[model samples]
Target: MRVLKFGGTSVANAERFLRVADILESNARQGQVATVLSAPAKITNHLVAMIEKTIGGQDALPNISDAERIFAELLQGLAEAQPGFPLVQLKAFVEQEFAQIKHVLHGISLLGQCPDSINAALICRGEKLSIAIMAGLLEARGHHVTVIDPVEKLLAVGHYLESTVDIAESTRRIAASKIPSDPYDPDGGFTAGNEKGELVVLGRNGSDYSAAVLAACLRADCCEIWTDVDGVYTCDPRQVPDARLLKSMSYQEAMELSYFGAKVLHPRTISPIAQFQIPCLIKNTGNPQAPGTLIGASTDEDGLPVKGISNLNNMAMFSVSGPGMKGMVGMAARVFAAMSRNGISVVLITQSSSEYSISFCVPQGDCLRARRALEEEFYLELKEELLEPLSIQERLAVISVVGDGMRTLRGISAKFFAALARANINIVAIAQGSSERSISVVVDNDDATTGVRVVHQMLFNTDQVIELFLIGVGGVGGALLEQVKRQQEWLKKKHIDLRVCGIANSKALLTNVHGLNLENWQAELNEAKEPFNLGASDPSGERVSPAEPGDCRLYLEPGGCRSVRGLPARRLPCGHTEQKGQHLVDGLLSPAASGGEQIASQVPVRYQRGGGAAGYRKPAEPAERGRRTATFLRHSLRFAVLYFR
Candidate 1:
C-alpha cells in the first residue's frame, strides 16, 4: 500500500480538487492506497483568525462567512463540472461543520474566552471538512471512501496544538482498524473523519505528520507529500528567486532544513517514516509531472558542497558566561533545566572552547521567559560575580546550510563565512553539531535574506559572477586587481567569475558594469577621461547619486559623511556599500590598533617616505618617516571620493 498526503494548496479549489481525484485514481490503479488531506489552502489560518476575533469580543461572522463561501463556491463549481457527483452530501457536510463552528464561536464571543479545546476543534474543521468533501467526490467517482476521524484511532497525547502521537498505540490501533488500503474495497479505506472525540489537533502541518504516521503504521512502500511547490529548493523560491530545485537529499538534511525554517515540510513529519526507511517524496500538486524531490537514507551525488540554505527569523541569542563557568560541571545542565521549566525552547547553542561561556538561541517571543529563567538559575553565580548577568540579544536569525557531502569537503565553513563576509552580513554566533550534516550561523534579522542568497550562490552556482568594486587602484587596489587577474583562470576552474565591475584611483574613474577587463584595467584607468570625484557636486552643485550596485556584487565606495577624527571613515569592511561609512576606518586601522607592524611592512617601499596631503615627503628621523609612510599607505589603501550617495 502507498500513502499519499495532499497539502492544502493541492486541493484548494474545484479545479484542483478534481485534479487530486485524478491523481488518486491513477495511484489506486497501481495498487491499494490511502490518502491523507490537509484543509483547502489558507482555510486553517482563516479559522484561527476567526477564533481570535470571537475571543476579542468582536463579531467573527464575517470570517465565518468568508470561510464558508470559499468551500461552498468550490462545491458549486465541483457540482457544475461533475453533474452526477454527490453534491448534496458535500453540501450537508460543510453545513454541519459550520453549524457546530458557529455555535462554538457564539459561546466564545459571549464569554470572551477561547479555551484550548474549542480552539483545536475550530482549527481542525479545515481538515475534517476537506476530507468529507473529498470523500464524497471520490465516492461519486465510483470509489469507496471511508472517512476515519483520527480521534477514533489515531491516538495522541500532549497539549492541545503541540501534541505528540502515541506511536505504538496508534500503530496497533491502525492495524486492528484494517483501514482498507484499496479505495476500491467495498468497505472503503479507513479515514480520520469529523468524529469529535476529545479533539486534539496536531499543530500546523499536522496533516503531514498524520500522513507519515499512517504510512509508517500501514508499512506502506512509500509516502508522498503533495504540496504547491515541486519540491524543496536550494533556498526558498519565494525569497530567493534563483533557488534551484534539489532532486534528492537525505532525511537528516531535510530535517535540518525543515527545523531551521524551510517551511516545505514540518520538522516532526520525518520521525515516523524515517524509522521504517520509507521513502518520502515531495511533489507539486499543481504540476504532477514534475519529478519533485525524494528524501531517503542514501542520497544521489549532486557534487555540491551544500544541498540547501534555510533560516529561522525572529530569533534572539542569549549568553551566560563568567569566570566561574570555567570547569563547572552542572552549570549548563542547570541552565537548560531552568529554561525547560519555563517552557522556553532553545533552538541553537554554541559554547566556548574554554568553557567560560555558553550561548544559545531561542524564539524572540520567549525572550522574557528565557531571560528570567537564566537569571533565576544563575542568581547565586551573578551575586558572587562568578557569572555575568544573562545577556539577551534580539533581532537575530539563524541561517543553516545543510548537506551530507559537507563532511567530506574541506574549507566549507571558511567558504560559508567568506560568502557571508563578501555580502556584508554579520554572524552573531555559530553552532555545528558533530554529525556535520549542517552548519548554523546566527545573523542580524535584516541580513537574513541576503545571507541566504549569497551563501546559496557561492556554494551551488559554479559559474557564479562575483562583482567587485575597487575604489583605489594604485597600490593595494592595483595589487588586488593583479591578484584577481592571476586568479581569474583558477577561479574559472572553480566556476567562479571574479568580475571587476568598476575601478577607480585618485585621478580617474573607470567603469564597465558588464565587467572591467582584468588584463587591461590599468590601461583602461590611465586612458579614462572622467575625473574621479568623491561626492562631486553637479553643475547645479546638487549631489549626483552613484549607480546602483549590481544585482549581485561586492561594493566599496567612499563615504559622503566624514567623522571628526579625519579618518577616511566611510569604508565598508564587508565590501558592501550599504553601511559603507560606519567602520571603514576601524577596519583599515584594525591591524595597527592590534599592535601589529605587519601593516607597515606590507606597505610598498616607494611609499615608505614621509607623506602629507598631495604626495610623500621625506621626514627627519627614519622612524618618523616610516611612521608617516605607514600613514600614507593607509591613506593610499583607502581612496575616498565616490560613494553611493
Candidate 2:
C-alpha cells in the first residue's frame, strides 16, 4: 500500500481538490492507496480565530461566515464540474458541522473560556468537512471510498491541543480495526482520542504525523507528501535566489533541516517513517510530473559535503553561568529541566569546556518565560552570589549547515566559518553534534539573511563572481566593458561570473545587481537620474555615489588636454604623479577603499603612455610619467573579485 498526504494548499479549492482526486486515482491504479489531508487553505486559521474571538468576549460570527463561504464556494464549484456530486448531502453535512461549532462557541462565550478539548473539536471540523467533500467527489466518480477516522483508529496521549501519538498502540489498534484491503481508501481527519477517549489534536501540521503513523502501522511501501514546491531545496529559494532543489536526502538530514526552520516538512513527521524504514517522497501537487525530492535510508554520497543550509530567526540566547557551575554534574540537567517544566522549547544549546557556562537559544516570544524559568531554577545560587544572573541576548538567529557527508569530509566547518567571515558576519554562539551531521551558529537577526546567502554560495556554488562598478566611461572603461562582453563565453568556460553591477560616468550612475545589460549600458547610464558628484564622499564607501572621497581621485584627460591634478590628501600612497601630457591609465576600481592596498598587489594591470605599451610592474615610486601610470594602475587594481568554491 502507498500512503499519500496532501497539505492545505494542495486541496485548497475545487480545482486543486480535483487535482488531488486525480493523483489518488492514478496511484490507486498501481496498488492500494491510503490518503490523509489537511483542511482547505485558511480554514484552520479562521477556526482558531473564531475560538479566540469567542473567548475574548467578541463576536465570532464574521469568521464563522467567512469559513462557511469558502466551503460553500468549493462545494458549488464541485457540483458544477461533477454531474452527480451529491451537493445537497455535502451542503447539509457542512451546515450541521457549523451548527455544532456555533453551539460550542456559544458555550465558550457564556463561560468566557475555551478548553483545549472543545477547541480541538471545533478546529478539526475542517478536516472532516474536507474528507466529506473529497469522498463525495470520488463516490460520484464511481469509486469505493472508506474514510478512516483518526479518533477511532489512531491513539494519542497528552494535552488536548497538542498530543504525541503512541505509535505501537496505534499500530495495534489499527491492525485490530481491520482496515479495508481494497484498491483505494482515503483516510480523513487528524484528531485522535486519548485513553479517556477525549478528542485531541497532534499539534499544528499534525496531519503529516497522522499520515506517517498510518503508513507505519499499515506497513506501506512508501509515503508521499504533496505540497506547493517541487521538492526540498538546499535553502529556502525565496531567501536564497539560487537555492538548488535537492534530488534526495537521508532521513536524518531531513529531520535536521526540518528542525532548523525548513518549512517543507514537520520535524515529527519523519520519526515514524524513519523508524519503519519507509521511504518518503516530497512532491508538488500542482506539478505532479516533476521529480520531487526523496528521503530514504541512504543518499548519494557523491554530492556536496553539506546538503543544505537552514536558519531560524527571531531567537534569543540565554547564558546560565558562574564559577559555581564548574564541576556541577547535574547543572545542565537542572537548566533544561526548568525549561521543560515551564513548557519552553530550547532550539540550540552549547557549553564551555570548563563547564563554567551553558548557553541555549529559544524563540524570542518565549524570552521572558525562559528567563523567569532560569532565574527560578538557580535562585539559591544567585542569592548567595555563587552564580551570575542570567544573561539574555535577544534579536538573534540560528543558522545550520547540514549533511550526512560532512562526517567524512574535511574543511566543511572551515568553509562555513570562512564564508561568514568574508561577509563580515559575527557568530554569537555555535554548536555541533558528535555525529558531524550538522553545524549550527547563532548570529544577529539582522545578519541572518546575508549569512545564509554567503554560506550557501561558498558551500554550493563553484564559480567565481566579480561585481564590477565602472567609475569612468572614457575610452579605457568602454574598451574594458567591450572586452568583457566579447569574452563572456570564455569566462563561462573558465567558471567565472563577471557581473557589471554598476556603471557610472561623470554625469550619472546606473546599477543592477542582476547585472545591467552591457549592450544598452551607455543608454541606460544616460537616462539615470542619480547625478554623479565627484566631490561628495560616500559614507558607506562601497559604491560610487555622487560623493567624492576625501583621499584621492584619478582623472584621465584626452590626448591633447592638460593633466588635471588629483585631489590632495594626507598621503599620496603610490599613485602620485606630475605628468604634463595626457596618458591612458586603465585599472579595475575596487569599491572597498580599505582593501585597495591588498588587492592592488594581487591583480596585474597594463599601462600605456605616449603611445608606448609598458608591461606589468610592481607598485613603487616611479621616476618617469609612464612608470607612474603603471604604478597607479597597480595601486588601483584593488577592484574586488570574490571567488566561491
Candidate 3:
C-alpha cells in the first residue's frame, strides 16, 4: 500500500482538491491507498486567530465568518464543477462544525481563557473539514471511502498541544480495527488523544507526523509527502537563488536538516518512518511528473560531501560557567533539567573541554523564561559565588551544515569556517555531532542570510563566482567590458561564473543580481535611475562608502579624482597593501591621494605572467603606447577578477 500526505498548499482550492482526488483515485486503482491531509491554506491560522481574539476580550466573529466563507466558497465552486458533489451534505457538515466552534469560542470569551485541549480541538477543525470534502469528492467518483478518526485509533500520550504517539498501542489498535480492504481511506485523524483519551494534537506542522505514524502502523511500502516545492533543496531556494534540488538523502541527513530549519519536513516526521525502516518521498503536487527527493537508509556518497545547509533565525544564547563547574558531576543534568522543567527547548549546546562552562541556544522568544529558570536553578551556586552570573546574547542565528558523508571527509569544518571568514561573519558558538553528520554555528541574525549563501556557494557550487562593480566607464572600463563579453564563452568553458553585477560611470548606477547584459550595458547604465553619488556628500571629495562585502571594486577613471578615503579598514575582505603607485584598499582601486588624477601610466599592472608585480613600460611609438595601455587595462581587469575569487 502507498500512503500519501498532502500539505495545506496542495489542497488550498477546489482545483487542487480535485487534483488530489485524481491522485488518490489513480493510486487506489492499483492497491489500497490511505492519505492524511492538513487544512486548506490559511484556515488554521484563522482558527487560531479566532481563539486568540476571544480570549483577548475582542470579537472573534469576523475571523469565524472569514473561515466559514472560505469553506462555503470552496464547496460552492466544487458543486458547480462536479454534478453530483453532495454539496448539501458537505455544507451541513461544515455548518455543524462551525456551530461547535462558535460554542467553544463563546465559552473561552466568557471565561477569558482557552485551554490547550479546547484549542487543539478547534485548530483541528480545518483538517476535519478537509477530510470530509475530499472524501465526498472521492466517493462521488465511485470509490469506497473510510474515514479513520486519529483520536480513536492513533493513541498518543503527553501534553494536549504537542503529544507523542504511542506507537505500539496505536499499531495494535489499527491491526484490530476494521479498516475497509477495498476503500480509499482519507484519515484527517491527527486529533490524537492521551491515555485518558482527552483531545490532543501532534504539534504544528504535525500532519507529516500523522502520516508517518499511520504509515508505520499500517506498514505501508512507501510514504510520500506532497507539498508546494519540487523537493528538498540544498538551501532555502528563496534565500539562495541557485539552491539545487536534492534527488535523495539519508534518513539521518533529513532529520538534521529538518531540525536545523529545513521546512520541507517536520523534525518529528522522520522518527516514525526511520524507526520502521520505511522509505519516504517528498514530491510536489503541482508538478507530479518531477522525480522528487527520496529518504531511505543510505544516500549517494559520491555527491557533494555536504548534503545541505540550513539555518534557524531569531535565537538567543546562554552561558553558564564558573570555577565550581569544573569537574562537577550532575551539573550538566541540572542545567538541562532546569530548561526541561520550564519547558524551554534548547536548540544547540556546547560545553568547554575543561568543564568550566556550558553554553546553549534557545528561541529568542523564550530568553526571559530561560534566564529565570537558570537563575532559580543556580540560586545557591550564585549566592555562594561558585557559579558566575548567566551570560545572555540575543539577536543570534544558528546555521547548520549537514551530511552523512562529512564523517569520512577531512577539512569539511575548515572549509565551512573559511567561507564564513571570507564573508566577515563571526561564529558565536559551535557544535558538531559525534556522528559527524552536522556542524552548527551561531552567528548574528543580520549575517545569517549572507552566511548561508556564501557557505552554500563554497561547498555546493562547482563554478567560481566573481561579482564585480565597475566604477568607471571610460576607455579602460569600456575595453574591460568588451573583453569580458568576448571571453564569456571561454569563462563558461572553464567553469567560471563572471557576473558584472553593477556598472557605474560619473552619472548613474545600474545593478542586477542576475548579472547585467554585457552587450547593452552602456545603454542600461545611461538610463539607470540611481545616481552615481560617490563623494557627493563629502565636500572634501576624499572618502567614498565601502562596497559591500564579497564584491570587488575596480576604478579606471583617467581624468576624475574620486578616491577611497573614508572607507573603513575592517570592511576590506582582502588585506590592504600598497604596490607600485596604486592602493588596493577596501576591495577598491583608486589613486594614492585625494584629488589626485589616475592616469593609464599610474594604473598598476599586478596581474602579469609569472605572478609578479610589473611596473608600467612606456613605449616609444604612439600606436605602441595605445596597444600597451589596452593590454594594461585588460590586465588590470584581471586584478579585479583575482580579488573577487
At residue 34, give the lDDT of candidate 1. Answer: 79
Q: Any runs in candidate 3 off by more than 4 Å, and if so which?
A: 468-490, 500-645
Name the lDDT of candidate 2. 0.76
Candidate 3: TM-score?
0.80
* Top-TM-score structure, candidate number: 3
The model with the greatest lDDT is 3
Question: lDDT (CA) for every model shown?
Answer: 0.70, 0.76, 0.77
What digit string (tens of lDDT, one per residue) describes model 2 on residues 493-525? Answer: 765666666676667767665567999888889
Q: What tens-digit string does per-residue lDDT give for candidate 1 at 1-645?
A: 788988888878999999988999988888887788888887888899998988877777787888999998899988988757788877887898899988888888888888887787778888777777777778778777766657777777777776777767877877788776456321111123222357677777777888888888778899999898999899997655557898898888888898899998988889898999999999998899999999998886565668899999999999999999899789899989998898788899999999999999999999988888878888888999999877889999999989888889898898788777755466889899899979999998867765776677667764544444556553334545566676678767755555666666667777653467887777888998866543343333455344333211122221111211222223234553323322332343343244321110112112111111212222222233234322322222122222231
lDDT of 3 by residue, 1-645 (tens): 889999999999898998888788777778899999999999999999999999999888888888999899899989888778999999999999999999989899899999888888899999999999998988777778888888889889888889989889999998899787965778884568787877799998899999999999999999999999999999998777678898899999999999999999989989999999999999999998899999999968338678999999999999999998998899999999999999999999999999999999999999999999999999999999999989999999999999888999999999899777755567999999989899999999977777887788778876555545566666445655676677667767766656676676667867665678998998888788766533322223234344443333333322112232222222123432222102332123222223222121112222212222222232222233133322323211112322221
- Each candidate structure's TM-score, on Cα atoms with residue i matched to residue i, is 0.73, 0.79, 0.80
Off by over 4 Å in 2: 466-490, 498-645
- Model 2 clashing residue pairs (backbone): 533-546, 536-547, 536-548, 537-547, 537-548, 590-639
Instruction: Pick the winner on lDDT between candidates 1 and 2.
Output: 2
